[model samples]
Target: MKNKFQAILLSYFLLLFSGSACDTPEPGPPDAGLYHNYAELTQELARLQAQFPELAKVVSLGKTVESRDIWAIKISDNVTANEDESEILFVGGHHAREWIAVDVPLLLARNLLENYASDARTKNYIDNGEIWIIPLLNPDGHQYSVTTNRLWRKNRRNNGDGTFGVDLNRNYGYQWGGPGSSGSTFSETYRGTAPFSELETQLIRDFAIEHQVAAMISYHNYSQLVLFPWGFTNAPAPDQTLLSQLATTMADSIFAVHRVRYTPEQSSDLYLASGDATDWLYGETRVPAFTIELRPRSSSPGFILPDRDIQPTFQENLPAALFLIQWSQQGGTMTLRLK
Candidate 1:
């Protein structure tokens, strides 16, 4: 498995990242596949663990405001122990409406496990590296999106008034209360009363730090961008060159799969979103963090990325992830210093 993984690293590395422009996507309605609801996601994680006990391990980081378990699916060779293997963390569903974001990581987890034996590359990564997939980070918000509101963006944290949530992305400790972050309870981008005030954000923060994740990608949708940090500010990150290169490589890999173009950018390029997960992960853990805003950049409706797009989205992002895993194993993954 390791030999094949290395073989892929040498052979497909160039094709995946530095390939020629792919043709435009075919015109059609993206398949509205069965997007998983909160309950379904929990069950799916459990099923993966049950089926692949050696490679898959399910554990709850903590519970959300609504008391839903924030599950972590750890896929690695030594599932029970945290060995020397370099870890790459993938988190999705920060916003409930970005249903495609949720499925991407879930699909990634499923593919890695189901193909462990049959696929040599998958087997190599699973057997040698630690891949942590947290498919639904904001479960309460996801549930809210499904039942009450289709566009809920925050966790179900009831503010003192009538408002019901704080944007988890905007509530991280780094750059808290800065521009692009909100203080009003009713605001969709609310930064919360204080940083890491919500259990969900705090849980992720603590877990990522404890595990010392080498690289982290927080998934979102409707932008078709691969964003690197300094999300809180316009200043370049210390590891700008490497970060930019990796992000562009991933963007190129995604483009090659679906012929969909995704600009590799700094978060502030689109807008100022302070206290976001990417920035916090980098500042707090020195993990080379990225936020991949998935598919249908201009034409598709913002958050309502169709169900059919889920498979292709994952297909495109997987190669970049594989590249990152291999790079981390070689100890060149995260170069930025912790703040």
Candidate 2:
């Protein structure tokens, strides 16, 4: 009897422990394994260049706060030469936690390079246009988000007040410090002490000014939105009509792929976020700028999108990206007046 009771007790304890373990929540999303870290992204870019050396060149625009290279891949027929082709820029990972943003542009670059020889449209874009893709802009913040805190959203800048970061998106020079941004260092949308404060923002600004970037897309996430400039206010941009039409077309392209509708609207319609990159790119350079918020139209999956969704997300966004690239070739007709 005693032996049987001991055996029963052991089995009960084991069952209780197993049940408790199963009930415990996961420390992070199980799908976090699906995304690449900064090092992996660097390696992938290197591999792509090696595979398509004639058409792709990887260049480091500058380093991030953590000394990670802010790499940009230029894809064109004459990748090494500065040809007089309309340049289209695609930027991703503006906020560290937006992992899908990084993947979409990276995949877009890979797709274009891989399809150049076989696809006529892909070949045409590469032959006639310059496509610049910066897939990981905030590498430090991204690394931190991937390894330490999944929710981290800013660059790892020490604010000297024990606070750690500045929202890179809100660090641009145009209409900076306006509504929808915070001056407090602890705020998520904290604009830095001044415009173009972060090295990341400064490098991008300098690069855009140096290149004749005709059209630009900066990808963010969780909203499924295709946003245009004038994020600073509700007032219409000088090129509002043209911008709206283009935005609608891109949104339509995105919808056609997965039947997932992404709202086309002004950035201010979403919120009055000043110092954003798209606003600065349009306000200062007269470039046709857009902010594409990708995937998980709802907050359920939020930033931690699953591995299965990665390819599909890239697939849907690819058409929209190609449309923008093709649009750049058309001169991106801007109205060119002050906001």
Candidate 3:
């Protein structure tokens, strides 16, 4: 009886302590058919590069905390060489749960490459300028969101406090630790221990510094808005007029397609989000940067946008993206003042 009781006790302890023994298995990765996981995205990028060897070049910016390569695809006529051409950057997936953000940029890349042969505007954009698309910036968090928690927003940084992430969007060096960010590791908008504390944001900072990017768009989701810089403060940026004009033009282009109306406004008008990519890109590099919050104008569908809506959303945003690429070639004047 004693031995039997001891065995039972051991079994109980195992069941209590081991999550796999008692709890339901952690949810498997999301449906591969619906969305692209890190591996799938990597494969897709490789396929694009192979399909259009001259027009597309795939390069790794760096590795994530999970050691996944943060890939950036450069599309241009002379993809191999860096010529004296205006460069435009389109980044997506800053927040892991914002899967649509990733999809749009990837689709933009595809549309640009596939239509280059048939479309005159597409050909001109590629032949005359350099377009860089970094579709998945926070690959670690993205993989986690796909495989573990569907709502994970920040990068998978072991916070040393039982928490596991630092919001990459809030980790940029410009106006960091200001409003709309958190100091606590558990907060969704936690700015890391310091500016550019996370590797992902550091990679972006270095890349922007190295490249003379004329214009940039960091895609987000669920608001249907086009926002310009000064997210950290209420004060207008020195190039506010130019920024607002460009944003209005992009918003107008989006409206023309599918009759979608994306509001154009200052980033801070929506919320005071410091250390964001839009502000950092403009503040540090003087690159006219915009953050385009993608489809579904409200929280009903939120981040879990349906697969069917993906194409339509991409379709509506394409003209706006092309407009930015065209504008980059124009060499718009930027004020030297920061604020």
Residue lDDT tens for model 1, 185-216: 99999999999998888888888877778898
TM-score of each: 0.88, 0.89, 0.92
Estimate, for each residue in 1-339, the C-alpha lDDT of model 3 and write its tens digit: 999999999999988878766454576855545668888899999999999999999999998778889999999998999988988889999999999999999999999999999999899989999999999999988888887788889998999988999999999999899999999988999999999998899988888767767889999997999999989999999889989999999999999989989999999999999999989989987879999999889998888888888899999999999888887787663633333
Candidate 1, after superposition: displacement of residue 78 in Å?
2.4
Candidate 3 TM-score, C-alpha based: 0.92
What does candidate 3 score in Cα RMSD to the true structure? 3.8
Tell me the spans in candidate 3 whose CA falls farther than 4 Å from its real position. Answer: 1-27, 30-32, 333-339
lDDT of each: 0.85, 0.90, 0.90
TM-score of 2: 0.89
Tell me the deviation in Å of residue 53 in model 3: 0.4
Clashing pairs in 2: none
- The true-versus-predicted C-alpha distance at residue 99 of model 1, in Å, is 0.8
